[model samples]
Target: MLESYLQVAEVMFMQVRLKAFIIFCVYTCAKFLVKRKCEFKPFKMLCEFGWILTVLLILKITGITTGDFGTTSVFDGNVQISFNISIENFSIATLLNLILFIPFGFFSAGVLKKLRSKWIYGILIGLIFSLTVEFLQTFIGRFVELEDVLMNTMGAFIGYEIMVLVIKLKDRMKMGALKVE
Candidate 1:
């Protein structure tokens, strides 16, 4: 079972990487061409690249990319939307959902200037993204769960906190270095 999951993940990673590469190339070219007067910021570009990769990976892993919209009828009954807010639903899948959004939150917090100091914005962004995914899943014949949204939001919050911690640690290290001088 684990091997199957790994294989699927490998395939998904390849596909997302290809797509992200093309998108990034176009984005980079456009930025260079369109904003000739603006100075390039490598750090900002890196953050944007990370955000793109993270979103592409998330979309691929969520089965949103694999769905055949034209062939599968929405009423065919394969579509499952669970609004169950039960503790019993907390399982490996829930953990995976949480883990999946951590990178999203981290990148979002890094890329969006407003999200750096304000954690609420991060959580809200996570919630909105999760809700959008879940809603889109219904049309794609994937199972949509409310628990996933909750877990994903929590994961985003954790990721944001982790980024904040890292920033603080780096600042402390800089301070220490100055003191040693």
Candidate 2:
């Protein structure tokens, strides 16, 4: 079972990476040709990829709606009422859901640069994105849990905080350099 889980994870990871690469390439080309900005920034590309992968993984983790759907079938549409406490449930899936949105917030603010200045935009986008995923899951005959939404938003907030810290640190370093000069 663990091996199968790992295999599935590997496949998902590959798919996410491929999609991210395509998006990055398209954006890079557009920026280079349209804006005439051709700076070689490897870290920026990596951050973009990470953000894309994180969003995809979050969707996959939360939206489990692919299956038979009917009143009698197992895919009966439902909304989850209870929260899964990690301490009591001891489930990795729950933990994964909680941490899934961090990259969405972190990479959005960290790499997008525009979003870094307006951090609320990233947080709002993350919330709306997670809400949409949950809403879609409900329509597809899956259980949408409020707990998942809360956890996802919390993860995004954590990521946003991390970005803020990094930015502040970078600014301080620059200030220190100016003083030394």
Candidate 3:
């Protein structure tokens, strides 16, 4: 029980640190962009990096591309045998994929140009990105599922919608503040 508690604490700490780092990066980038009179879109390299990191972390957590040969057997040290897939496994994989792509969608929306249809653009990009990842996984001796693409796209769409909502809320607050002044 104590060990579990420690693990939970460590996880929480890591999450907080991750959030802080992301916030810091955004703040610095915003400052730079504003000072330079550049478009303050979030389409910087850091946002792209965040998307890539999300993909890698998802793959790592799924344990498919980790080169973990314990459950794998390389026949004659040349070919890797395939693993079985079940409905439950597919469901879990789908859920994880969806969760993994949410950040990408959210960040992409922020980085995209100011347009009411940016969320649609984000969804399309997310779908393409997910397809590319799935294709790459196939070449890497990892199992690729069509369901994962659907789930990831759905996740990205939902995330983009949330971002849109947040932006609207922020605009409203700003307008309200201006009225007060």
Candidate 4:
């Protein structure tokens, strides 16, 4: 038992292939460019993907999503993996995936603000980005789970709301005081 665990740990920490790292780099950078309208720094997304990819690499190294990557399942013989979290394994990776995409929605709202003021637009933006990621993952041999899409979009919506509320609060505070005589 201990030997199996040790083997998994050793496998998981091995240097991630340059090809995989580059793939993540290109993908994350492309998303950064798409959200460029707001003129905000892309620094946040750098950190976001840095952490996200790190988690993914770690999972891959450890073989957590082993035995065939897809949205399928069977109790015996066949093994399956879900991109989303399960009731039993409420782990850090699940939280990180949800947390990492918040900036995508928040800054995306900044981009959308130039066109229109709509929270639904933010939601749409989140869903689109997440769907793109999820679908891309399917090609990359990761499970594409709808449950992950829902949680990721929900996170985006929350991020968008926070940004909107902050702007509103700032406006209100400014309007309430310090009039020029």
lDDT against the true structure, per candidate, is: 0.81, 0.70, 0.63, 0.59
Model 3 agreement with the true structure over 87-122: per-residue lDDT tens digits: 666554456567767877876676664523745676
What's the C-alpha lDDT at position 28 in model 1? Answer: 86
Whole-model lDDT, candidate 4?
Answer: 0.59
Q: What is the lDDT of residue 107 in candidate 2?
A: 82
Model 2: ten consecutive residues of lowest lDDT: 65-74
Q: Give one digit per residue, the lDDT tens place, for model 4 in 53-172.
A: 544553453244443544433324243346554668755555655665675566555445541287687678778867766655554355567667776788777777876776678677
Error of 1 at 40 (Å): 5.8
The superposed Cα distance between candidate 4 and the true structure at residue 39, in angstroms, equals 10
lDDT of model 2 at position 36: 82
Candidate 2 lDDT by residue in tens digits, 1-181: 5567558767777666777678768877887999787788676777877776777766555545233434432354244445544456645655566576787888877776776777677678678877888767655467766677777777787787788788789789989999999
Q: Candidate 4: lDDT of 27?
A: 65
TM-score of 3: 0.59
Off by over 4 Å in 1: 37-43, 70-79, 174-181
lDDT per residue as tens, model 1, 97-159: 888899888878877878887778879989999998887788776778889999999988888
Judging by lDDT against the true structure, name the best candidate. Answer: 1
C-alpha lDDT of residue 155 in model 4: 75
Clashes per prediction? 0, 0, 0, 2
Candidate with the greatest TM-score versus the true structure: 1
Q: In model 2, state the lDDT of residue 130.
A: 75
Better of 2 and 4 by TM-score: 2
